[model samples]
Target: MKHALNNPYITRNFNPNNWMSDIPIIDSLSLAELVLPGAHNAGVDKKASYTALGISHWAACQNNSFYYQLTHGARALDLRLEYAVGGDGVGTFWFQHNGFRSSRSLESLIMSVIRFLDENPDEFIILDFHQLNPGNQRFDYKEFNRLLLTHLGNRLIPSTHVFLTLGQLKQASHARRVMVAAENHTELDSTYFCEYIEHEWSGIGTASVSELNVHITKVMKFPPGGSLPWSLSATSYNVAEGPVNIREHLDRWFDPALSDWVLNSNIINADFFETSNLVRHCRTANLIKANNH
Candidate 1:
């Protein structure tokens, strides 16, 4: 199962809690794969199946009523494929899959989006990377910067900014700021780069962004703890004017539906897959932010 993950940066054994336990933890990657019923599946009569399909479709649609209600009438989703590699492969996109069920669940959503981008390789999508944590003496900024430049740079169209959450970055680093790495490290200072979105895209010989009808997601939130969201910052591509204090507000921010995120023991974490009520709140908050913008 681990071999199936094609990501070079993340492998099976990338464990941060090695000292505490010996069990291998799966990477928190969003890979796309789904279990759609096959035509050969047992129990259904083919003649009746096709005849009843139209009614089934409507029934199913009605069953998933939350989709229309939540999206405010926007049914079909638009994906903004942001490629990660130069061959026009890895990237992110935005789509409206109705709700967080089946294919739209977080894991399935990630997988489907990537699959769409992978299959449509010629359409050089936009690309960008953001630092997940605050850059301080604590992180290996130099190495991460190098990796970004080598792997993800030049591929991401210009003016596509990467977000770095410096909410906890204090100027002083009296403690040791050792950036340990099993494989990679990078850092960049005073780095600001931009170019025409197409200049870099043309290198891949793909369809124009306009032709693809790619609609960018106005807001992308990478809440701390990487779950539904315990703490939220303006993690969008755009930065704000004043300072944002994530710790103070997010430390104990509570909602009851969050219990669904609880993982089993050291095996999982609170809001691990982000299914709890907290996720709903976060998505709502994100929509609000998008509207405000």
Candidate 2:
């Protein structure tokens, strides 16, 4: 059976090269008013770790590089960082998912985002550092923050100003600004670290499509007049029978779920983000909101 996500029109209309071109006024909308396409485990690729069960079961969430994800209209990134130890007793930062190391280092991922922002100055991104995993070694939060500031430089949007609308953000600065949310790092300056953003739900661990849909709809309910920006995750975390084929799960649920909840969602994060019309859908939702106002 063919999946809705396989439609040729989706590919043609939402091509990465010009995805943002359609939404010229996107920067002017409030963050909550815009429905941003997000990537879950945004850094995970073919290089992620797996159990003896093989890569099929523990396959990575994303197929393309970070550069590709950004160019394709993924504005929000779910990042997990860890301290990696080498044989020389030296530790470096790495991107990890469930303790599995990604092929790309943390430094490389940050550089990719920096490069993207350098080229596309009008586009802004929400970088959610959702987790910091320390594997067998003690992790230094301060050091990690230092590394982030060193690479990101002046591109970061001051934390105090992140709650504003896209237009307000653009008006505030000429350089592109990225909203950085370092989870559990409340001690950092408010100008760079925002602790109020909420992740409504994550990881629907089911293989049954019907059951998954039920769970997705149930968690998607958000209260009216909420202040913080929240995300509704449309990706599955585990499959009961085999390796996690997130693409298959997305093909089955992405369209239906978006139809039901896109209007209310702040961000719709999924796996294999480039394979579907997620960007178009988000833009449409934003347009609908704009019209209602």
Best by TM-score: 2
Tell me model 2's lDDT, rounded to 2 decimals. 0.67
Q: lDDT tens digits, residues 1-293, model 1?
A: 00122333222332221211121121111000100001000111111122232332211111122122112211112111111222454322111111111112223323332443343321111121211232112443454445444543433222212221111111122121111111122335223232111111112222233321121111112112321111111111102211112222121232112321111000111111122232222222222222332
**Tens-digit per-residue lDDT, 84-138, candidate 2:** 6788987787777777766667778788887887777777788887887896677
Off by over 4 Å in 2: 1-18, 47-53, 202-204, 223-225, 237-260
Strongest candidate by lDDT: 2
lDDT of 1: 0.21
What clash pairs does model 2 have? 57-243, 159-191
Error at 233, model 2, angstroms:
1.6
User: How does each model score on lDDT?
Assistant: 0.21, 0.67
